[model samples]
Target: MIRRRYIDGRYGQVHLRENTPLGEPPLVCLHATAYSSRSFSALLAVLDGKRHVIALDTPGYGESDAPDGRIGIEAYAESIAEVCPDRFELFGYHTGVSIAAEIAIGHAARVDRLTFMGIPHFRALDFAAWRSKLAARHVLGERLDQFEERWRFFVSERAARLPLGRAFENFVDELKAWPHGWWAHDALFEHDLLARLEQVRQPTTVLNPPGHLAEPSRRAAAAMPDATVIELPEMPGPALDLYADTIASLLLAKQFVGGAVPA
Candidate 1:
């Protein structure tokens, strides 16, 4: 069973969802922007007995305390590292990828390896446009119609393949972090991600699912010194929930071959 708890962190309290069946070094997970650790519930369930896993809600999201003001990706990485084990492999999805990369670069001794579901590599102009567009969507006191429009956009474009219930759960997570949902994106676009990826010397795996991020993820992987790309064209929309077993098997196999421990 997955258990939830909180630990003192840089911001105040950091909420964590953990499943620890064995005593091996844990695999720490970080979720995408606006979403919480709950996004990894399905993934954690599949890896329950096979490997110990802990998924954290990035500061300012889920039950974790919000920061005093907007911070950069490095701050996000530091806050997350403050609550992580001294040594462990890391897995990140979307926005979490940026934070994970920063951690691997800044806290090299702590992170053993890295796994990213999507690594966004956008041009300066493109990123700026995207930041502006997303910021507009997240207006604090937007009209109900605007909110509904955003909801419909998420369901149709982002969560099209997700089951109704699962999609709704994700949407609710977005709502819960509505006020600061754009903060991570702001930090992400401002960071020198490609340079940081190049600095990450840890063994890395990039899982590329079919979507807008697929090409960018491939390009980002090319810059990393030690990285492998696993294309998941067949798995679309929320691979954590849809392809949990596959992902779990791959992660276990990697750790076993690396002499970490047998899953």
Candidate 2:
């Protein structure tokens, strides 16, 4: 079974959802912006007996305490790293990809291998446009209808590929992040992820699920020294609940080959 706990971090208490029954180095997971470690709930369950996994709530996003203000990607990486094992594999999704890359680069000795589900490799102009759009759209207002509108948007747009209940779960996670949720995006757009990815020396796997980031993930992979792109054409969304088994299998296969598990 997956379990939850809190650990000391640079920010205060960092929350984690983990399954530690397996006898292997843990797979440290990081989630996308506005979401939390809860995003990996399904995946944690899937890998419960087979692999040790720990998913962290990025500071200010989940049960973790929010930072004093907007911090850079390096800060996010460092804070999360404070709670991670001395050595392990890493997995990241969306904005987590940026943070994971930074962690792998900064803490190279600790991270053995890397896996990324989405890479946000936007051009300078594109990055600015995205920040502008998110800033204008993600404001939390006092009106109740504004909140309803956000809910409807998630149901129809952001989490369309998920079931109604699953979509609602995501929506709730997004709400929990509130005003600081946008901080991750701010740091993401400002980070030179390509440069950081190039500096990552670990073997990396980029899962290319059908999404806006597919092409960009490939572009980002090319910058890395040892990275492979695996296409998941059937996965239209990054809902871990729906694709946990598939994701776990791919990760396990890589781990086995990399000697993360007994051959």
Candidate 3:
């Protein structure tokens, strides 16, 4: 069962959902922007007894307290790291990838392995476009209809499998975290991912699922000193929900028995 808990950390109270098995090195998961640790619901369900799996809500992005100022990726990394075990593995997606990479680089001894999906590779020019979109999404008119409109548009794009009620709840989760959502995007824009990846010493796995983020994962795999790239040619959104088992297999094979070339 996934249990929700709070940790008083440097920033403030950090909320996390976890399924911990006794004596195993924990698998700490970080989520994408606009989403919380709830993004790993499916994965956690499947991984419940397999290992110790902990999914953290990035500060200001879930039930966690917001930082005093707009912080960079390093601060985000520090927040998550403060709540983790002395030795653990990492799973990160999109914005989470930036934070995870920073942690693995700076605290190499604490992380046994690193896994990333939807690794972002953005150039300086992309920030303008991102800022425009962020501005549009940051609609806080204090009108219920406006929130509903935003919720519908978001659900139409990603949560088709979810029922309307559950989807709306998830959308509200996004809305409640809106103030900090754009902060993650800005941090990603400023992050030097290549420089960070070069410093990662743990064994790494990059999931190359077809999407805007796939090519970046490919680039990231090449940059890592010891890394394995898994080619998953499915649409990223649905594939992420359905392929938790596939990822579990990789983690088990690599970290438990023996690592091998992905078949």
Candidate 4:
């Protein structure tokens, strides 16, 4: 069973969902842009009953309150670091990938292992254009129709596999983070992804799913001090939800040895 709770984070109240709340060296999971810890509900259920997993609703995304002013990846990492234990395994998808990398680099002593999907890489020119686009989109309009248009587009492109009710819920979550919804992407595009990855010293795994476009993830994996890259070409589309069993197995192998993390 998943339990809901809150942490009085430095920036604001941070919400979390956990499978095994008291299990040690928990697997700290982060979600992509506009999504919450709820994204990992299916994966949490598949893990063994004794294996602890905590999914954080990153600040400005879900139930958590938005930070003051614009912040970078470092700030986002610090927000999570404040709540994490002395050492834990980290897992993330999309935007969460960059956050996980930042945490590993800045708080190496606190992170034992890392796993991520989609390491974002952007050319200077591309980032400049994206920044302008995101800046314009961040301002939510007054029209309900405009909101509906954006919601429909997001659902069709990203959440098609989800049930209608769940997809709507995601759309609502997106609406809640408006004005700051683009903060994470902006931070990611502005940072040097390769440079950041090079700083991470922990044993890491890059989980590549077919149909996902992320050349940077492969490059980052190759640059890490100790890393493993696993490409699941046959398992396509949002690997986190569709291939929860495969991912859970991988973590179980690396982090769960005799019901505990290896020393």
Candidate 3 positional error at 226, Å: 1.3
lDDT of 2 by residue, 1-263 (tens): 77899998888899999985577779999998888998899889878888899999999998999899889999999998878888988999988999999899888899999999878887623766777865444666787776776687677676545788777877888789885678888888888898888999999999998877788888989989999999999888654767898888887788678466533
Residue by residue across 113-221, what tens digits does model 1's lDDT show?
9999978676523777776865443567846664686578566566555787777777787887876788888888888888988999999999898987899889889
Residue-level lDDT for 102 in candidate 4:
88
TM-score of 4: 0.89
| Candidate that beats the other on TM-score, 2 or 4, i.e. the better one | 2
Model 3 weakest 10-residue run by lDDT: 131-140
RMSD of 4: 3.2
lDDT of 1: 0.85
Candidate 4 residues lying further than 4 Å off, grouped into runs, are 48-50, 124-136, 156-160, 256-263
Question: Candidate 2 — worst ten consecutive residues by lDDT sum?
Answer: 254-263
lDDT of each: 0.85, 0.85, 0.79, 0.79
Quote the lDDT for 76 in model 3. 92
Against the hidden reference, what TM-scores do the models get?
0.92, 0.93, 0.89, 0.89
Instruction: Give Cα distance to truth, residue 222, candidate 3, Å.
Output: 0.9
Order the candidates by lDDT, highest first.
1, 2, 3, 4
Which has the better lDDT: candidate 2, or candidate 4? Answer: 2
lDDT of the structure predicted as candidate 2: 0.85
